[model samples]
Target: MHGYANPARFLRLAKLLTAPLLIGGGLLAVAVLAWALAAAPAERLQGDSVKILFVHVPTAWLAMGGWSAIAIASLSELVWRHPLAGVAARAVALPGAVFAALCLATGSLWGRPAWGTWWVWDGRLTSMLVLLFLYLAYIALADAATRDGQGQSRIPAIFGLVGAVNIPIIHYSVLWWNSLHQPPSITAGKSEMAAPFLIGLMASTLAFSLLFGGVVLARMRAILADTQAEARLRRRAMNAADV
Candidate 1:
């Protein structure tokens, strides 16, 4: 993995792999969306509105998954000093934030019919909201630290590690409080969801995960190119000053 941290190596591999990744991700996304929205059975309670689960649940899952990736990458940057760790961490922030917002928005849309309100201060919802804010804060902190030349990698890396505390809080919120958001209906011990619904949920989860991976890879490549360009510019300026 560290060997691929070299920008040249990464670029070479990315160029080779880009077409396949794009094709696979696109196909999976389309297939999953079709299966989830069109083929899955309507819930006994929520009816067609349950189809929103295909989008909402997957976005929520990816939002957490993205943050976990950031936390792991940040840890690598701090401990292993991996050059690409910071890039990966920063690359994931925007998509994570967008997905977090999507999760909240879709949850609210689903809630209106189910919970009888557009918004609620319930434990799970509030914790998820905090997760969204954490994503925004991480992006803002990273952007500021980079622009001020106050050290780009270390500050945001530390912030990411610290902010990761929210992940557990969000996960356990339903268990710990009397929230409107129901506890996991598809638990290991008791599976309440029908087989078709569960299948759609799993497919959607896979599609979102693939989409997130492709997006992060694309963003990281762009960042590496920009960094290389900046270095070349600085070298040119130095050579001119010497002459």
Candidate 2:
């Protein structure tokens, strides 16, 4: 990982990997979504509403996973002082928030058909909503820190680490409280879904995860380049003043 601390090395790596990730992820996601929509059998209970699973579940996974990335990056910044740690955290915020919003939107759509309501204050939905708010807060705080020229503020990192506590609550909320949301259907070594549904879901998850990775790497490279440009401009100004 430290090998990536060198911005040049990281840029080369990001350049090499980003295209493949985007292309491959795009192809796979399209194929899986097509399959889910056109061929996958409707659930015996939920019927066509089950189709939303392909999109909703993956976005939800990415949403939580995004924060997990932020928390990990924050930890690295705080403990190991990884130079790109803040960059990684910043790269994650917008995309994570987008996915979280998508999760809520899709969940709402799914709920309207399945639960007879468009929104619910149930444990799972409520906690997931809170996760979205957390993402927004992190983005705002981190952006403010950057704009204030206090790039080294530990506030965002601290918040990232602390915000992670909500993750497990979001995961376990369905189990811990009475809710309209369904419990976990797929678990280690067993799945309640049929093979076709599982296959479609797994493919969708992999595709979106790859896309998320590509986006993060690309964002990191952009941030590094911008930072370098600013540093160069600063040095040039100082040199001119001295002359």
Candidate 3:
């Protein structure tokens, strides 16, 4: 991380990686989603609704994972004063919120047929909703700092750290409270899902995770470009005054 602290170094590497990550992720996502729709069999109970799992599960994972990235970046900014940390946290906020929203939307679509209603105040659902709100707060706080010309503030970082408390709650809510959501279908070393569904879902998850990384890198590069342009304009104004 410190090694790439220099914007030049980071830009060089990001430029090298950005295209591949996005292109490859896009191709893989197309393939897995196609496969899931065509090949993965319908569940006996859920029937064709199982198709939603590929998109829903991946988005759900990313919603939490994005916040995890923000929290880590926030910690870096606060503890190590990593110059890029706040920028990174900011870069991820929008995408993370997007995924969180997707998770909710997909869940509702699945629920309507599965549960006879669009939504319930199930523990998992409630916690995931809270995660979405946290994403909004972080984005607002971080954007406010940038707009204020304050060069970043501790508030966004602090909120990122504090907001992470919701992650575990989202993860464990199904277990902690009786809910419409099933128990963990997949876990470390073991999965209860049939082989084809398991494989397709994992493939979908991997593709989306790559997409998320590509997006973050792209956003970070854009932010750096904007900052550099602002600095150059400031220098030009100063030089004109000296003249």
Candidate 4:
């Protein structure tokens, strides 16, 4: 990890890995989605609406996973002074927020048919909404800190760490509260899903995970380049002032 602390090393790696991940992930996603939509049988109860699961589940997983990345990067920044940690956190914020929003939108669509309502203040849903708001807030705070020339500001890092508390709440919400949402279906070697659905879901998840990683790395590379350019301009200005 420390080896990646060098921006040049990291940028070279990001460049090499980005295209393969993006292309491979995109192909896998398209193929699995086609399979889920066309070949996979519908759920016994939900019928055709169950097809949404392939898209919704992956977005939901990535939403949580994205924030987890931010929290880890923030921790590294604060605790280890990892040089690229802030860049990593910034790189992930937008994608994470997008995924969270997608989760909310898709969940609402799924809920409308399954729960007979377009929206509900269920524990799991509500907590996930809060997670979206937290992402937006973090994005704003981080941007403000950066613009203020406090690039290494600990405020955003601290907030990132605190926001992680919501993750566990989101995970356990269904178990902890009376909700319309179902409990764990694929935990502890017990799965309610049949083989077809399970395979499709897993494939979609792997595809999205690859795509997400590529996006994060690409964004990190861009951020590093901008930071370097800014530093160079500042140095030139200081030298001109000295003259």
What's the TM-score of each model vs. the native? Answer: 0.94, 0.97, 0.97, 0.97
What is residue 204's positional error in candidate 3, in angstroms? 0.3
Model 1 residue-pair collision total:
0
Candidate 4 structure, TM-score to reference:
0.97
Taking every candidate in turn, the Cα RMSD to the unseen true structure, in Å, is 1.6, 1.1, 1.0, 1.1
lDDT, candidate 3, 45-139, per-residue tens: 99999899999999999999999999999999999999899889999999999999999999999999999999999899999999999999998
Model 3 spans > 4 angstroms off: none
On residues 156-232, what C-alpha lDDT tens digit does candidate 2 reach at each position? 99999999998999999989999999899998899998888888899999999999998988888888888889999
User: In candidate 1, what are the lDDT values of residues 21-72, reduced to their tens digit?
Assistant: 6678778879988876777788788888888988899899899889999999
Candidate 3 steric clashes? 0
lDDT ranking, high to low: 3, 2, 4, 1
Inter-residue clash pairs, candidate 1: none
For 1-243, candidate 4 gives per-residue lDDT tens digits of 998898888888899999998898999999999988789998889988888888888998899988998999999999999999998999999989998998899888988889999889989999999999999999999999999877547999999999999999999999999999988778887889899989899999999888888888889888888999999999999999999
Q: List residue ranges in candidate 1 displaced over 4 A.
A: 150-152, 188-190
Clashes within 3 Å, all models in order: 0, 0, 0, 0
Give me the runs in candidate 2 sitting further than 4 Å from their true place: 150-152
Assess the local accuracy of residue 98 in candidate 2 as a C-alpha lDDT between 0 and 100.
92
What local lDDT does model 1 show for residue 52?
Answer: 90
Over the full model, what C-alpha lDDT does candidate 2 score relative to the true structure?
A: 0.92
Candidate 4, superposed: residue stretches over 4 Å from native:
none
